[model samples]
Target: MFHKILIANRGEIALRVLRAAKELGIQTVAVHSTADAEAMHVRLADESVCIGPPPSRDSYLNIHQIVAACEITGADAVHPGYGFLSENAKFADILDAHNITFIGPRADHIRVMGDKIEAKRTAKRLGIPVVPGSDGAVTEDAEAKRIAAEIGYPVIIKASAGGGGRGMKVARNEDDIDVALATARSEAGAAFGDDAVYIEKYLEKPRHIEVQVVGDGDGRAVHLGERDCSLQRRHQKVWEEANSPALNAADRSRIGMTVANAMADLKYAGAGTIEFLYENGEFYFIEMNTRLQVEHPVTEAITGIDLVHEQIRVASGAGLSVEQKDVQFNGHAIECRINAEDPKTFAPSPGTVSHFHTPGGLGVRVDSAVFSGYKIPPYYDSLIGKLIVHGSNRVECMMRLRRALGEFVVDGIKTTLPLFQDLVNSRDIANGDYDIHWLEKYLAKADT
Candidate 1:
């Protein structure tokens, strides 16, 4: 195990990793921007350093400053909690150059899975079913039109380097193709600095499902089942559940083994997820996340596995302690991302919390760093906390989640709490009859 590890992100995820390290008898160093000086993770860590000013580029994204902090603190390893530079291959390479351990996948693995187009090809080669799309990046207007016509209408144009619904456009017909290509290219350039785009046959009601896998990086790996993240708005997941009601036992077993085998084939290290879009009964590969996901808690809740601990152990050169047969799934779990945003407008809400109260009970868990007086800084992502619950089944889980949502309180700030409250009562949500676009359409209907 690492003697000491430095966390290279802020907010709850930093705290999440800090606690995990401490449990393994590993000391922790927390690095933050000036704006996060009063952050909860900074307070809990054994050592803290202010890397730079408020903006991320000057701080969290600044590899030099973070490396300096690790050097000063004598941290032998660095854990980048998701987002920011979590999947940055260059960051991992830099850590390797410094002889500092990166508590995640190898740089090469990150590189292969970082680009969407490359990931699709890799997945297809690994025998994972992928959506029919362009043979490669469509750089020419004429080529894009050809691919679109080949794939049929209602196709989606996506930035090879894009996420969070950015740099994406849908063309239902030939007329919309030109504008979509131009706009998607421009947006992708602005967001990822890579104007490369790809085309895919878009399915209308695909459920977003991802398989959780952890590998020891020595041709051994394990899968902890799947999470259904179909309830999304603007391509951002709002709710996630383990033991997806959408999947059957046979499909779950098949996908889980396929992912684990692929990880073993690549000699992948630590934790990662193989995301897929499920339409009808077939699963099509979307992309892969090379690091821990925010929705990891739900998987852990149902599987009784500590993914963070497993990742650190794998990084420490230890083999996976649990085998595929040893893994067990019990009950159902759900996670609702409680962000600091308006329930209606979805605008950023950053301010001091006047009052805060989190729900607690059997099978209920809240992961947050906010307090009664914590001031939410506007410079970072709006997610403030996660409310996760577990139960004997999905029905019981939703009941607890709804009850927990009512008990959660963050006064003096706009939050998505109201939205969740409305969601739990939604018939579509109750029946697990939602897809990636279900939430967007639901919200659009509310405007009328």
Candidate 2:
């Protein structure tokens, strides 16, 4: 067991890790920037250290400062919450070199999976279904065109290192291929410093489903079912639910076991998620997130498992106590990512929260760090909180989410609350018949 764990992140996730560590009787050290000196995680931590200035590169992403804080605090383990360095292989390696435990997967897993190209190859080699695409990176426009033509028209050009809908372009025909390739490479280069691009046959109206898998570091792993994250805007997930409505029981079981077996074959450790695009009852591997996901609350709600706790345990050389058969999915769970943004325009809304009111009930859970008088820093993501609800069925979960969203009150800043409210009342959303492109199309129609 870890005596003291240093959290190398900030905001809601930092607080989430702190609470989990404390529940396990472990002391926590919160490392924050000067801008977050008065942050909730810092205030609640057993000890707090100001690492650097406000900018992420100066503070949250500074490995040296974080390691220094850990050394000074004598934190034996480090929990990188979700973003920043959570999936940074170099950071994990550095921590290992310093004899500090990184509460996540092995460095190699993160390294391989962090690259989109390599991840797809791994998935395919592991017998997982992958979208048809080029064998490797299509560096030249000519090669990209060749690959796109071979894969048929309507191919998507993606950066080898891109995510969040950045560095991606779709070509519906040969005429669009040249522009798509050139622009994708340029954008990818600007965004990730690597212009390497690849091509994949685009599946229209696919559902974004991901399987959560945990490994015990000894070739043993289990899946905790799937999360449907089809409701997204700007390639960012807006809503997520466990037990994907798109999949039947048999389809869910097959995909879940496939991912679990693949993790075992790779000897993956800690927590990881295998994202896929589902179309016409087929699952195509998209990518693998080598750390906890932003939508993990829905999975935990359905499984009744603490992913943070299991991640720490696995990192400490403890085996996963629960077997595949022992794991059981419960009721349906839904989560709405509450972001400080304009409901219609999706612009960033960062300011002082004048009043904050959280909803309460049996199935509603609000994972947030904001409170009255808290100033939301503009340096980080717009996500301020996650509103999660669970119920015996999807209908009940939807109703509960609607009620909870109505009760959630945040003043002095704009939020996407109204967007979710409208979604909950829509007959299309009520039937859970949405695909990955649904939200963007819905929003587009609203603009007119």
Best by lDDT: 1
The TM-score of predicted model 2 comes to: 0.99
> Model 1, which residues run further than 4 Å from truth?
none
lDDT by residue (tens digit), candidate 2, 89-152: 9999999999999999989999899899999999999999999999889877778778887889
Cα misplacement distance, residue 196 of candidate 1 (Å): 0.6
lDDT, residue 297, candidate 2: 94
Predicted candidate 1 versus true structure: per-residue lDDT over 246-265, tens digit per residue: 99999999999999998888
Scored against the true structure, residue 327 in model 1 reaches a CA lDDT of 93
Candidate 2: clashing pairs of residues: none
Indicate the TM-score of model 1. 0.99
